[model samples]
Target: MAGMVEQVGPPGRDDITAYAAERTGGASVRVGALAPLTRPGWVQAGRHLLAGMELAVSEVNDGGGIAGRPLELVVRDTAADPRRAGAAVEELAGLGVAALAGEYHSVVARAAARAHALGLPFLCSSAVLDALTEEPTDRVARLSPPQSHGWQVYADFLLRAGHERIALATEPSVYWASGAGILREYVAPRGGTVIELDARALTPAGLCDELAGHRASALLLLAGHPEPAVSIVRSVRRDPRLAEVTIGAPAGQPEFAEWATLLGDEGTAIPFLRYLPERLSPLGARVEAALRARLAHPPSFVAFEGYDTIAVLADALRAGGAGRTRPAADWSRVTVEGTRGRIRFSRTPGISVWQWTGAPVQVVDRDPSEPGRFRVLHGG
Candidate 1:
């Protein structure tokens, strides 16, 4: 999909006779796409992610269907469970999907990547964990920037904002721990200090007490959504002693529309990291409009990540990764003009998976005056 998704309307279908096969009474090149579709998972993010993948698949199929065979997406709901995700990866592989793509949670993606040790290529979509796998392999590639990369950007934003003494309210999760560690490492030498607060041990009120006692000007939420994160925000906002504190969620929790629906105007101005450029490319604009129609709301960067995942996979199939062992995660040959920018994979020193080095990273938040609008605070 070199100049990928140039036109974003209904994908035009080609010859149907070429689509005959044993399964579904038709021939389709299948890619198993995973997302957290049910509860305990971020459903809004999943919905947007799926929407983008679906749209891209439709376009790919319409655009002549990978050597005239229809492109198919076999989607499974991970539900934020690592074990379930591992199982899903096995099932998808058994069903003979040419490759695997899409997973939002880092922990769950790690599980799927582990199960994927069986040798199927996996193109990871939203997960940003630096160590996606316990060890590196040639069979996997990633779309989102790693935790270390994005967190460094967020840390830089914090330093520029003069929030040297920061408080990170965190849960006991690998993803959260990695993020907290990244912020601490990146901010410390620059004269910033990170204070860790155990969100699990601290009630919202107690967390507020800690924030006040520590006198931290900035508090970054590194915990799960709606529970501790939302609760902590509510408590901090209500506490008079913490009125001057700047609350942040660099984990991109505030990117989804549901965040706004849940926290309303209060969610505005709480900066979070998002993977979008300051301005959309022509292809991005078209995809963004199409995504809005499908999602019935503005699509988050996760949705664009999903769309770009398909665009790259489709291009890879065209480049011959559809054969049994040569799957779409082949980073060397892929050069997709994605919705955000040109997608190309390379090895950075610390990142384990084949990573797209050019995905744009930004720190943005909903405008306080107009909660529906997003304002970019920093970009890197």
Candidate 2:
């Protein structure tokens, strides 16, 4: 009683650290993981997801563990396929885990429905699809920015850049189409028109000819990947008239530098809401820093989403009493600043409620002033 002694548990548990240490002495807290760990495209995302979860678990164990039980992680590779995701979850559930986390692809999120049905806590790591939270369901919570947040920023960038007539290029895939739909919906009522383009039917040259014929002021490239988008950017650059048009892409990534080089003065990269300077959440930053430090590489937007997923699960576990967080946790006001800003839960189903946040979209004009650096034209 030199200073003060406090009891942290209901009964028989006095010292929190010591109690956790004793409880965790031999037992392991198992967490289920579902991600595409093998594919190169998903390599960074998968690693970052595991890295974040591992860091949180290590930090907890270092802090004397959760109720004295050391956290153990069980990961299953989903290979970025939705069909494989279900099998992976079944494998994890068979392992008898306390909680599950990590998901980069939306299709993988379908597994959460099963996890929810099983009364198991499903922590979303990287699934940005808004539909995940649209329906109110227990045991599933996301720690990443929803796709709608990302789409709003894309639309606003077009409006501010003086883009009047817009064209959309989107694949038939669910995620790509979902984002494209958001962009179209945002543009429709504002006196702006969205022209949908079919990738399969039209070549880059065909799109350029059509844009030239229509005199569209701007174009939004919403394809599934950068491979085709880059070709379109190149095609647009070739036509002197098309070069004057504003070009934007949702979630324009580092690969865009190539397009920037090709378009030269004609290109403009729309800032993704996820990459905005102000969108970085505190927990997201911590998770990002930890993963990058360990992997020796910067985490991409998708990778950051993966990291956010793990952090959310850890928080839920810590907030809930030892081994009591499955299906339900005391996360009513719990806020985790993920890579996309403050992520908070809502009562809605299939859509995890999040704070409204935006970032300045940079319009890069290769200049005599900066040479390589692209200057900010709209939101900075």
Candidate 3:
């Protein structure tokens, strides 16, 4: 009988802590997707947006469906248009989604603000421009590092590389312009200056003339448009003086590779800051499979971001005692692990910063295998 006891499952190790899966229940939380899904230009990034949201949903469901009730997502395509974004928000609210995510473009973020005003919490994953946070609502939360943090990281990279004098090519849009300003603010205080070049409507001659005057050590592309940024890089690289300067960008879009191809082998050496490593995400793989399964191709960062936004919201809802009470933790303790990074909102200043969240900024060597892929050079 003693020999037959068989250890009894190793004495049960320890008591089981209640997992997130244990409590999720009925009255399914309706999570919404707000994005420019219809626009071809946005198609590249938007796919990643959706993947992030889907990943969160799928993972929650797989882990016993969030407090016993599975999450249901309501997706809305904003088509990169503000008017359409507003309409989609109305539609999702009508369907009664408990929370929402997505909307990378600042234009669409405004639409999200309207939805949040109506009581739905809008948790953004990809849209990081500071303007999005200015919208008054406790319902809005962002997981991505703000543009200021990203700018500082980029500036630090250039400065550390000994490129103290820099030239900037920036888009006129609030997102890029404000991002450039933030970069300048960070760079200037550190004894470096960033000269701005407004590329909104600059002719080739105008761009050349501006480039000719500056004895720049580095070039920073503050423009969001890949075409223009690539064009500038290609044009500048031809000039012997500019060819020697290091070119830096926030993130490399596939279009940057096209630009690299045009610029030749020299372009491959350009360094960029990556917010999220493409291959680092387990959810990214799942997102790609889902996109290929449904849409016949893999998704992009924007789509995965959209999916992640929803995933974070689902976590918050689950942690918030399923609407019973707020997830009451102090500012330092108030954190939610998000797809992009850990999210913690500041209680006093009442704005989000990368420091409190503990997200690392990485300087990466762009992947040779995939132009969009990257390997961490410093931080991970």
Candidate 4:
């Protein structure tokens, strides 16, 4: 498979005629994938995600597929809209998909509550809202760390970096709010003070002026989207008063390269928590090479996540057999090796549902001179 990583072509089709002797006969297992494919906010990332999913599906089919059955992905554009996401779930369910995956927005993932209600297994690829997996559901599992866990990683990094007073610049969304709340919860009890600011209401110059009045060591941008976070970063770079203050954002993970491109030299040294580190494992190197061969640029963390989601689903289908609902116990026992590390899901103490808690979160920074180089500061 190492030599085949760079092979670019259409995925192989399962030959049902050649598999007539198989016990159950050959068939394609359809998996539903919901992503904001055409939405302006997430289209680029969504495309990379789709590519990753396709790569996994291709690899699976190449290896003779699950029990001689091919895996087919039926993707739909949710547009990051909750109503549209709900409709997509119903449509995929109507199509009789064996499983579901790929949701980028927390709001859209929440709207996919129909998957839980319908007893369809949904492996969430990237949505990080804490509430998405806060309640137990036999049919739902999230591969990404929750927003609270990511914030906890960032908060710990800040504390370790000697930041005592933190300023939170947040967008007006449930995702951002949940992240901010988690950051405060983690920081406050540890003798750190957090001051909140409205990221959406403030202009670049206005944010600089507001930050000048506060005596904070660092500013944590909790905006889930790139616009406000990019605005905040540009403002901080332009203002001399904020020169010494470290600017960071957990939401910057998916769009780090794009933000770095836009910010140029100003983007350097801005710490952010990313699920995958700058350094790739041997498996990650192969995945990266494969992605670079197919994509215009290198794949993002979400792309790797998309690949992992489908890979896990393939494992579930194999372990539980096709067209059958596996008990949550059986699903919990299934694990696969991912690009980052070992992938597994478990119900944590605070979080009520099963989720992949072992996110290889690392605080990374863009290099000042190297165009695409990133330095891993801590963790992972």
Candidate 5:
């Protein structure tokens, strides 16, 4: 919303592709988009991410675009596969997109590796994997808080909630393992014990049995959604022994609509991490309204991340297109007025990408009384 581009206009049409198409005419400055639009991916998160990105693209076009060239979004569905994502990055690079933006976690990791190798600037929209690339490089900058930071915040929330005996329902993944390790390390130093449950080997009922036997006060889901997550929640809620146990999802599974659509009332009160400020800036407020109108639902934090990703890239492109964003050597110099706040990137100690350290993080959940609403229980 700052720099050469103007603020987004008021919400009018939900169909942004049609709206963007009607107003723009030029060679077009294309920004390649990544998302898990299909199965094996969190499709709802992808949908929300795309909604925000699409809204930003439309707004960039309406503002006379970059150097009079219309801004364009070339989307590729990552389909939740790492190899598939790597291929997408290679293909997008070949397509001559000015930069890249995204939705998948591991999917983004794979894309990050390839993008880093090719020196393609990638503004990651949602992935939080700590080791996005094998080594440090300037080619990738991230909008989301990393797994270490966000999951540590979640661990603190659990500690404050008097949940000292915690259990993790973990699936096999470097991402999941990293998150669990973060929580364990943060919680253990404060006298909490973390138990790991094999989500792959255990049925929902067996998971519930393990939870009850341990007398664990809290259960954190570090597994995939719908399959084990939904079933685990259901089994735990139905079992009388686990009634008092707290349910958490540090991976943000409950943030999507389908989490509620599948689990319904049982899913309420299960806290998850979301990266949103307690209050939105005026720019964030306007974009939130537009995104809600476009999405026909309250936009998640991931949606805001998508919008901010485009916003940062657009500002860099306007300043100087490829020279500013192609190699991403200027990530430190990129300071754009994003929807959330002023966005800037810097090197973090453990992270490999140019990290936005200021993005807000919160622990929130659907209220049990009103399943449609979210209640902010903790924030950092």
Candidate 6:
């Protein structure tokens, strides 16, 4: 029976405690949210991520919450910095958050060592580094496939598309490095050859020259950021010799509209590995509508992942109650209907930790006429 509560500025320890006290009336479940709210590179993505988390929290509270206790989010800004991320987790722990979620950068998620140390259940929303959940731990889980698994899916798509020689290009980052490594490991054994290129170091002319020099049937641009990937694709498409080369990117998955607009005609028919299906589930539809109403755009992959993270956490809380250690075990058995598909987790191969392995991985391309619409080439 409490009125809607709103707080201005970034949440601090005292802010979180006071907000929860005012909103929950002393009986609420607090989930910690660590994201890059003001980071230079990740501010927009961070906003959408927070929006999704808020949507999920609102829906859970509207539905009587977990075991009739209101769910509250204690948000902190990490700015995608590793040290800040680790400290944010520690701060959240000090605030007595039952679980933690919301991180977009792999470097930041890697700093989740504190979550393991504190034994608080941490669900990574969108960080895709393979090592995030590589080690077995009862306190950690990820909702997105690791870079290796996602790249393997991309490799399979390329193989099925009759492309044998693939050129891999990427920026210098841990996220892209893990993806490139997986592409190399997966492509060679499958009778495919990979030509690797450092996209960050390449000038537009140099990129075109390199693409012209290689007889690659397709180019896999794995830049973790969108600008480099868009630049590479735009440059490659201009080369007459490589005019027909199939272009794909993992970076475009999160921010598809910007990539598509930057590439223009060049973006058509290009494949990208994405976490969500082209179509939404009933829950997905509701989330998309809510996002459109709130943010004036449909939920992006980051938003969907964020929504699912809290949904999964709520399910775990409902089953195990608050303050229960080892919620990862409970998370492993939870199968919530998410925006993408039926959300579930299992121990990832090679990583040896429970992860949301069933995330809908699809190779989708932008519709030439409809800039925002994507057509699924493979998977669903």
Q: Which candidate number maximizes lDDT?
A: 1
Instruction: Supply the global lDDT for candidate 5.
Output: 0.82
Judging by TM-score, tell me the better candidate of 1 and 3: 1
**Root-mean-square deviation per candidate:** 4.7, 8.2, 10.7, 4.5, 4.9, 2.9
Candidate 4 lDDT over 1-380, as tens digits, reads 11011111223323322332252355567788877777444776777778788888878877877787767777788877889889888977887778888888887888885687787888889888877744677678888888777768778989999999999887777777788788889999999999988877888788778888987879877774457677678889888888789887667543446676677777777787778955678888898888878777878788898888888888988888767355322458768888877888887766545688877787777767774777777773
Q: Which ten residues in a row have the lowest lDDT in candidate 4?
A: 1-10
Question: What stretches of model 5 exceed 4 Å from their correct place?
Answer: 1-26, 323-329
Least well predicted 10-residue stretch by lDDT in candidate 1: 1-10
For candidate 2, what is the TM-score?
0.75
User: What tens-digit string does per-residue lDDT give for candidate 5 at 1-380?
Assistant: 11111112324323433444455543566777888888888888888888888888778867778777667777777778888888878887886777888766763554545776776788888888888887888878889988898888999999999999999999998888888888889988899999999999999899998998999999999898877899889999999999899999988898988888888899999999999988999999999999999888899998998898888888888875653234533688899898878899999999988999998999999998988899999988
TM-score of 4: 0.88
Give per-residue lDDT, candidate 3, residue 129.
67
Kindly provide the TM-score of model 3 when superposed on the true structure, using C-alpha atoms. Answer: 0.75
Best by TM-score: 1
Residue 272 C-alpha lDDT in model 1:
94
Residue pairs that clash (backbone atoms under 3 angstroms), model 1 = 12-62, 19-27
Q: Please provide TM-scores, in order, for all candidate models, with all chains considered together.
A: 0.93, 0.75, 0.75, 0.88, 0.92, 0.88
* Model 4 CA deviation exceeding 4 Å by range: 1-26, 253-255, 277-279, 324-329
What TM-score does candidate 1 get on C-alpha atoms? 0.93
lDDT of 3: 0.60
**lDDT scores of the candidates, listed in order:** 0.85, 0.60, 0.60, 0.75, 0.82, 0.75
lDDT tens per residue, model 3, 1-380:
00000011224212211122233424455566766655433555665566556656766767765566666666667766778778777877776666666776765775566765566667776666666645345666665666677667777877887877888777767777777777778888889988888777775446656766887787777665456766776677676756577777775443233444555544555676556553445645555576557445445445545655655565667666444234211223346554445556653243532223444456665565655454565443
* lDDT assessment of candidate 4: 0.75
Clashing pairs in 4: none
Clashing pairs in 6: none
Candidate 2 Cα misplacement greater than 4 A, ranges: 1-24, 38-42, 255-270, 275-289, 301-304, 321-328, 333-344, 348-380
- lDDT by residue for model 2 over 193-268, one digit each (tens)? 8888886678989988888888888777766444567688778877887867766665553223344455554444
